[model samples]
Target: MVTYRAYIKKDYKAEIRWEPDHPFLAGLARISFMTVLLVIPWLLLGMKAPELTPTSSPVSKSVITSQQDRIIEPSAIDNGLVIDTAYLPENEIFETTGLEPPELEEIIDPINDQVTEAAWQSVVVSKGDNLARIFSRLNLSARDLDAIMALGEDTLVLKHLQPEQVIQFQIDDNQFKSLKYPASLVTTLHVVKTDDGFRAETLTEELEIRIKHVNVIIDDSLFLSGVEAGLSDNLIMQLVAIYGWDIDFALDIRSGDHFSMIYEERYKNGNKVSEGPVLAAEFVNQNIPYRAVRYTYEDGQSDYYSETGRSMRKAFLRTPVNFTRISSGFSLKRKHPILNKVRAHRGVDYAALSGTPVKATGDGIVTYLGRNGGLGKAVILKHGGQYSTVYAHLSNYKQGLRSGNRVKQGQIIGYVGMTGLASGPHLHYEFRVNGVHRNPLKVELPQATGIPEEEMKHFTTQIEPLLAELDNITAKSGLITVNSHSDLRSSVL
Candidate 1:
């Protein structure tokens, strides 16, 4: 420590002085003063000599033996509480007599932690929501997001968030633990966090596919009869498609014609989810029975086939478009509605709603795509060297369909519209062979490839039971259609 002094004189003059100590001498003096002060406290307390050696008191051997043989009991303390100090080991008593023990740092294993159960939180995906946004909403870090996405490409499915899809999260202490994301109607992706890292797996459910049989009598129309017989519109369309190769649905369907269907229906968790393909069906038109069965080959290719294993698919679909009615038939000298003059009508006009899809009847390459004089927005397909098909009066052509692009059979090529000299929205379809116009409704189409000889035995075995069931249903002419829920089940079983 340094000291400053000031001296005042009577003549208004003042003198100031400052002194500093030498570092080595000041350090020795400070230590000596602290040592004397410490010893003075001890001397004033009358402390004589410090005990250097610890003292021990000897106990008799008989006393130690008696203490071990006695049964100690809890004794009442001053606070009226029972104390059980007698059960504590002697070493514990020695430890408690000294200073308090030091606190130990705990080691926590995440996987084996006592607080393992996580509270589940469910969030429905909303529009414009993504996985990162959801993670941020849950106060999760970007590092966690990266770790989860590291699961692989399949884990990226979390990025495709659909509105209203439920995504579940298991969170503990505001940390992400696991996730349950429904990948599809029958599959879910389960992502879990482990001690090492995040793990992901796809869990799928097996749906039960059962056969269903339905018999219906045509009273007014196929649609009405199918609806009355408890058949979905899709199933009815499939039924018409199976036999469309042999029958003309627009003109040949009779009121007395009847049909039977054996199709596949899928169920999940004891509840029907949706309908599958038509396994077998029979439609009698004009007293002619047309039977078709769906068969799958060993190579995993499948199609509808006849009872003799012949393919039901022809070279062309019967109707180019599903239409309301035949507005005009193929004619030779029909009066034009727009021109008001007798003109040679070479094609059939199918009346349909505007923007209805028009399909290519056969697999062929587009030969022409331009606006004709009367047939506007037209497409002409050349099948082989001799056969050609024309579709006219379209709203727009199918994207990517050009002069050289090849289209398959029943592929949408254009839409119906009232373009160029036309009356309303309708499809003007024409078929030509050897550069000669032919009636589309009457022309015979080629047959597609049938089942191979090696697969014929398997095909026969599968169709036998389906045919027997059809025959049994047909034998009961007056048997009512099973429309009730339980009756329908019985019919299939």
Candidate 2:
């Protein structure tokens, strides 16, 4: 207890004092002295214990008497009997209480937690590893291997096992039950030991395709930007192919160019397996934005189109070979490089490596594919109508290509080479309409077919959402590598 004190002076101050023996409070806090006195009631009365609920599964008991009379005596507790609380004996309850008994799931094993897992042994195929060698390593019998080999043509795939392929099997009591070999991403070879012999079957895994978004702002080149955006080489090549018709990646790409697109990624067992085709894309090259969306008609043919239903592709490609530079352009009355004579330059010469693939600009028939006077070995594609293109200075033509064969657009028909009247490895390409020669670089290419007028509404309705998603993803997240994972549930079943 504390009390305040006041002293009268020029500077009055207050003081606090403690009162240990307070007069107003009496007979307080005598615990140590009253400890023995508290046990007087226990000495006069007695001790008792309460019953407890069983924490384990109850064991049922059989009784011939009433619930109150069925209580066992002390001698009934035998020490030799093993008590299993896991299961109850099939009998009535020893004591009939009015309250309802609890179920086995109410307090224990509520979810019926009983699961059996397979014991599978897996082996990875290394170099020079064959089926016989693997079976011998696993201590498998030769007769079983012979029976597996005799199962026919379906089992022939097992004869050739490539490195890194996995083989899994289940064994119990030194007996093989089943075996599996993953042949590819989509198929698995399964063999089981039947009562008669061995059975082989191929099982296919249904793949799940998910949409992935990537936005890239070019700092130096498209390849570097795509790498920064975490794109694979295959995906970058696909992107180039999608825009190869409108823009030449070799010469037209600028530093500030940016693009956004949503593409497909295949997944199995929740892990990404491979990449798929681009669905929709927007590329802004030198401040000019070009957008394309994939559209499929009822005939099962698919193509890329603009937002306004214009085809993104043209009748011919602008650049045929992946060249390093333009050595010569189409000009008239220009001094020749080798002869040093004023001559009419009719074609553009593209400098490249010797074996660089030369692509066909348009679908056409091969009219000429042999040596000319100074043009050397060449292939001329005669397109439908009055259009024709010539490829000169070839090293060697693509195999399986001959004169009078039909070639598709962007198909490799020959390779870049310096065969005749040339100084280095290059290609001299000329574009001709009717009989008049046109510059391949500046010639306005013809347009390809687009969506029909009747199908414009359908095309717009189907492709708009994909474009809108790509736009939304770009708007929410700026130019960076992002995997949106917006569940379109692409093809999962």
Candidate 3:
């Protein structure tokens, strides 16, 4: 009888050996074993390993280096050294060696491949996460962060981290080897450990900006139609800003008005990273077409211009705030909603959700920034010689706006609110010429500087193709949704 211990100690080949006195099952088992042994050797000898051919992309983790006959030892390496192979007899193209290559000495900088398996780790910023907190979680000392910050202003961006922003790091033997922070979609900050200490550099990625086209007709609202036409909310806001000086989108956009645009879509490595500025756009408001193309000059100054070389920007913004409705218009004999009495309405009341930004209509200085008799939280601005504007009924003023403070056009001076005597959150806007009230909607706005005579030819050459593309795609050409999870940093530093 074969015991468990005895069976384990016995040589298995003996049990399978063929013998005429053995049982028929034992003989069959021996034949099957021999066949399997022979078949396995044959199959293994005939099989081939998969060949690794080079691809168009960069190789990761390892470099394919062929073994050479010669050896390179660091101890024997001399900068001015040269070896002569002439001593070997009759060696034309190659030589044979018996010795194996020596193991390489450590390099000063850890190459991407030599950094150990999965050495690089991505650290995600959590709520209330900062650089100190992130470093602490990685078991990194405060000195490491201080050393990184000491690198200079280029590394200053790492001081602030937003939630969900990824910070990549590499560690070797509990020592910080390198760190990479994405400053923006097109810019990355790299910190590498060096012999001199830590080195910081900003690596900027080239932006491949491709122009995307869109054409949509307003069936109800510009926003609704724009979305259906594949326009991103970002692009829609850009479109509104471009034509905002001429058209009040809140009230003036009609059911049939069509919008066309050619804007920028920034890309990296064939993948889109961010949305760029609108290159050229056109908005036909009430059958009146207003076309604008962004033109950059030799000095790097850029602004939007019309086909006739007229500047797209007006002296004053048509609407001071993005409001839902025009609660009241200018009238000599009107019934005040709060007072319930017939009075002269000297200004246009713009009803908006509370906290909507109220912008300055033009470049001006604040003449008054206090509550008037009925205009609560009022701000009065004097524009150069003749024009002056009034904004009232605000929830709050811009942080530091004061009387005599200079304000540029489109600067937020206050917010929409119902402070003293208003039915809803609204902005009471009054445009005056030499202290006399004028209809803001009907008042003629001054034109900005157009293309210079010297640059007009260049402007036409650059702008013609953009205009043609808009005209050609008069059909329903759609835009795309923006990538919301994009890097927010604007530049490298």
Candidate lDDT (C-alpha), each:
0.69, 0.69, 0.68
Which regions in candidate 2 have their CA more than 4 angstroms from the true location?
Answer: 1-118, 149-156, 171-175, 299-301, 353-356, 452-457, 474-493
List model 1 lDDT by residue over 362-400, tens digit each: 899999998998898999999888889999999899988
Model 2: lDDT of residue 318: 73
Per-residue lDDT tens digits for candidate 3, residues 1-493, read: 1011111111111111223233653554576568667854433222111012222212210111111111132232354222322233323212332222323342122433233333466777898989998888788878988999988899999978888677778876777888878888778888887667888878888988898887788898776698678765567767776665566665677888887788899866444556758887767666666777889898998888777787767777777886666777778878788788888889888777999999998899999998777788999999989999999989889999999999998889999988878877889999999889998867777665678999998998988888788666653454321321121111111
Query: Lowest summed-lDDT stretch of 10 residues in model 2?
Result: 8-17
* Candidate 2 global lDDT: 0.69
Pairs that collide in candidate 1 are none
How many times do residue backbones clash in model 1? Answer: 0
Off by over 4 Å in 1: 1-116, 219-230, 244-256, 321-325, 336-341, 351-357, 371-377, 393-399, 415-426, 452-458, 472-493
lDDT tens digits, residue span 104-155, model 2: 4543421112111235567779999999998888888888889888988777
TM-score of each: 0.64, 0.66, 0.64
Ten contiguous residues minimizing lDDT sum, candidate 1: 9-18
